[model samples]
Target: MNLYAHYVKRIQDFLIALVVSIVLSPVLFTVSVLVKIKLGSPVIFKQKRPGLNNKVFTLYKFRTMTNKKDKNGVLLPDEDRMTSFGEWLRSTSLDELPELFNILNGSLSIVGPRPQLVKDIVFMSKEQRRRHIVRPGLTGLAQVNGRNNINWDEKFEYDLEYIGNITFINDWKIMLKTVLKVFCKEGINTEGLATSEDLGDYLLRLGRITEEEYTAGLEKSKVLINR
Candidate 1:
């Protein structure tokens, strides 16, 4: 019934990603070198994230933090490891440029729900999981709406709305808004944190699920991660 999601949208995503990657190659290269210099080796960070139909795929981004640990050998918190340069990269969203390769490889789209960490997917409610019905996007309705400023529930709602309404117009509108938001540097962070609040914490605080349920979900998620 949905022609765009079934066919045309992917073609559009492929074309747009290809063209954008080529056009932004210089920026990508500059970011890569800077990341190497500022963050040390491994300029690109790769992690498993849930993609289309909740399938796991390797997501890429520019490295923005150091791998420093405490005397106990425990890694430091994100806020501590993140450098001023890293913060700038995040604010400008240059860190996400490497995802062009993900789009090119057909693991992502130009517009859809942002892919989430595989471990986090375990905590997603049934309805929230619906966001993965389509391929993850480089920039999405949630990203343009408020990015990290919004709550996890709001993000899930926006993602579902986009899933239900897929068209050239909506896609382009989201993309345009994303570019504008990026330039304006809107919703770059939640409060003063580097990212939004964790959905697991949100669920737990709302009494939506108990500690036992959370632990069970983590176990289930680990199985998915292995697969």
Candidate 2:
């Protein structure tokens, strides 16, 4: 971990998060109500995500899926449980508003690498482990670029690039682009998966569709996600 990187980002994050929390309070309050009414009880979904130094921190997002299960007592996949309203919320990024609280709580920054789950950590290579050196964020270079449209190798490349070249200017650039991406519903998901192509399974099998196949597949997936 870089000492300068830690100190600089911490100070900047504190100030920005404070202001955003203050300004977004009304929107937050309103969304909480809508989530409760339309979504159900426990409007927010809190999950443990790996943060800076591989520490676990609770991540906040609006509940977009139901608790329904099949007769066998197995939960359904995201595609089945995700409601139309949930899809709308995700497309507009309304589902992410609760993360302002995460930013306020010091668990997240407004911009950084998106956090991965505990299970997802097993997928990262040693070289990719450096991403844990900084706090996870709500949006990042990966989010602003191709996001779920890109493969793991490409996403990791963008995440590492963010760590190496982060600055106030870069953060603002990503922020502005994120707003546009949200409106356009870009990089939300590929055709088949609602979230992403689970990198864990892919890496475990060392089985990403092959370089030649992947190049073509990702191009098609990119078009699908942006749509």
Cα lDDT tens digits, model 2, 63-156, are 8888778999999888888888888888888888888778878889888999966656655678897898888889999998887888788888
The whole-model lDDT of each prediction reads: 0.88, 0.79
Superposed by TM-score, candidate 1 places the C-alpha of residue 125 at a distance from the truth, in angstroms, of 2.0
TM-score of 1: 0.95
Q: lDDT tens digits, residues 1-227, model 1?
A: 28877999888888888898999999999988888888898999988899988889999999988999999999998888989999899889999998989988999998999887786798887888988888999999999889989888889889999988988899999999999999999988887676666667678879998999878877887898889
- The C-alpha TM-scores of every prediction are 0.95, 0.84
Alpha-carbon error at 61 in model 1, in Å?
0.2
Error of 2 at 120 (Å): 1.2
Q: Where's the lowest-lDDT run of ten residues in candidate 2?
A: 218-227
Residue 66 in candidate 1, Cα distance off native in Å: 1.0
